[model samples]
Target: MKNKILVIEDDRAISELLCMNLTIAGYETVAAYDGIEAQRLLLWNEDADLAVVDIMLPGRDGFALMEDFRAKNLPVIYLTAKDDVASKVKGLKLGAEDYMVKPFEMLELLVRIEKILERTGRAKRILTIKNIQADLQSHQILKDGIPVNLKPLEYDLFILLLQNKNIALGREELLKRVWGEEYLGESRTVDVHIGQLRKKLELYDEIKTIPKLGYRLED
Candidate 1:
């Protein structure tokens, strides 16, 4: 089952963008354009695994809404333009899982969300793509119900590409993520591993090499 996320933001454009991206990331999303609607959703016992909330709103503010979330044991990540230390401290003190400032990286936000869900035991354990199935908890992969042997780093790279499929990922960022930051490996290392993945999985056509970028595993 896809994890459901609630987005409570007054800005319709930002809310839509977040919902669309979250959907693309294999999540179900609900949007509340204002605090009043958010409060109503909460009162109605809307089901949500996590919430991305904006501080400023038409009705009740995020801080005030935190009480309602706490009452229901709902996890929250504050996404706001307010970058003040006091606000940050207060949001954390209010029991927010995370706090992100505006103009944030969408990829970073998606990663943070995935981490929070995993930490909270709310993330889905199995992922399926065509004939492939990945068991995240066991770190296992299967193709056509048969086990597929992969190196540890290969598994990590495969999972990363699967999670961020359809989006181009840079070689430098891939190296930093799959290999450790201190590995000091060349970008060619990524290419070699990607080649291995394609050959092993018969995904030579699905995984596209983006010129001047790196790769994108298309859905």
Candidate 2:
């Protein structure tokens, strides 16, 4: 099962983007646009493995929300546009696992999440999507009980597609996650690896390209 993450941000665009990206990273997400909605989700709707909270919120604010989250003994990360040293210090002092300023890179966010989960012993290793079994611990994949040998980049690309099943991923997003943000590579790099994945895995129909967009994976 994917880890469940609670996202408390008032901006709908940011919240939705976080949900989409986190889901693509194989984490289930519950988004709350305000503090009251956040409270309701925590109180009666869903349990969360971790929370990403924005310092500014409607109705109650992020710090107040942290009190309730702390009661559950849940891990928290503060994501806000606030870049002041004092705000960062206070949030860390208040027990947040990490603090990220806005306009951050998605790859960094993912790395931080993995690190926090690893520290808390909540990191996931086995991922089963459709007939594909990904054992992260071994960096191997099995399709329908048969091993599928993939080149290093092919395996990385395949995992990203499987995790974001049904969602269209752009070349930029794939590049950042798979090739690292500093890779300065061409979009064709993604295309070549994607082609390799389709041919080797027989996923011609399962993986699709969206016109003017990028690629989407179907179950």
Candidate 3:
């Protein structure tokens, strides 16, 4: 099952954008435009895994809405325009899993959300994309319900690509993530592995090569 996330923001554009991206990232999202609406949703819903809240809301700010989220046992990440140290400290003290000042990168937010979900033991073990399914716990990849043999490094690289699907990752970043910082490998190594992955997984169309950047695994 996809992990369910709640987005509590007054800005309609931002809220819609977040929900769209979250959906593309294989998560189920529920959006509430105000704290009052969020509280109403929480009262009716009992299975929200996490929440992304904006500080300034029409009826009750994010800080004020924490009690409702707490009552639901939902972890929260504050995504607000408020950048003051006081606000940050208060949000942390209020038990937010993370805080991000607005103009935040969507990729960073997605990564942070994934990390918090994993840390809180709310992450889904199996990740599905089309006919492929990856067992995160067992580190196994299956295509069409059959096990697909993958080398150790290939598996790690695949997981990285899968987790950050549709996001372009540079060769240096891929090298650092998959091969480690001390590996001292050339960028060509990434290309080789990517080629192997594309051939092995038969993902020629899905795994895109970004010009001047590196690669992006399209969902």
Candidate 4:
């Protein structure tokens, strides 16, 4: 299952950007523009693994929302513009595992979140299936502990296949999901990438070509 992240930020653009990057990183995400909405989301949907909260909110402040997350034992990382020593001290004092001021690098934030999740024993950065070692954090793939270098498109295809293991995914559907539908390319583009993956990573046995369909990566 993918780790789900709850983002509570009032700024529409920032919230959307965070969610987009989180999705690209292979994590499920939900967003609430205000603390009130955040609370509602948390109360009803209790499976959120972590939260990225902004201190300045419309209805409920991020500090107050921490109480709710604490009650549910959810890990949190404060992502706010309040870069003061006092505010940082307060957030850390309130049991936040990590705090990042605004204008933070997305990659650093992801690394910080990964470490917190790892410390809490709530996440595994390395995804394994058969001999495939997919390091989600590093975006690296390995076969039988040996490095497998893949082009960006090839890597994306490989990850998509693993994400839908044992399920048939049509080439068109693969193109839509991995390469985006607006991308001007034929379904044969997927076939070419799959061939490269099978050849380079020795995934020929696992990735089965579906007749009249797309493909399925069997475990």
Best by TM-score: 1
Per-candidate TM-score against the hidden true structure: 0.95, 0.71, 0.93, 0.62
Judged by lDDT relative to the true structure, which candidate is superior, 1 or 3?
3
Poorly placed runs, candidate 1 (over 4 Å): 43-47
In lDDT terms, which candidate is top? 3
Q: Per-residue CA lDDT of candidate 4, range 76-180, in tens?
A: 999999999999999999989889999998856776877787788778567767787998779999888888999999988887776556666788778887898
**What is the per-residue lDDT of model 1 for residues 1-219, given as tens digits with 9 covering 90 to 100?**
778899999999999999998888778898898888998888765567899999998889999999999987889999999999999999999999999999999989998998998898888889877799999999999999899999999999999998887778999889988897898768998999999999888888888999999999888
The parts of candidate 4 lying over 4 Å away from their true place are: 124-219
Count of clashing pairs, candidate 3: 0
The local lDDT score (0 to 100) that residue 206 gets in candidate 4 is 89
True-structure RMSD for candidate 2:
3.9
Considering only N, C-alpha and C atoms within 3 Å, which residue pairs clash in candidate 2?
none
Per-model CA lDDT versus the true structure:
0.90, 0.85, 0.91, 0.86
After TM-score superposition, the amount by which residue 114's alpha carbon in candidate 2 deviates from its true location, in angstroms, is 5.3
The true-versus-predicted C-alpha distance at residue 6 of model 2, in Å, is: 1.5
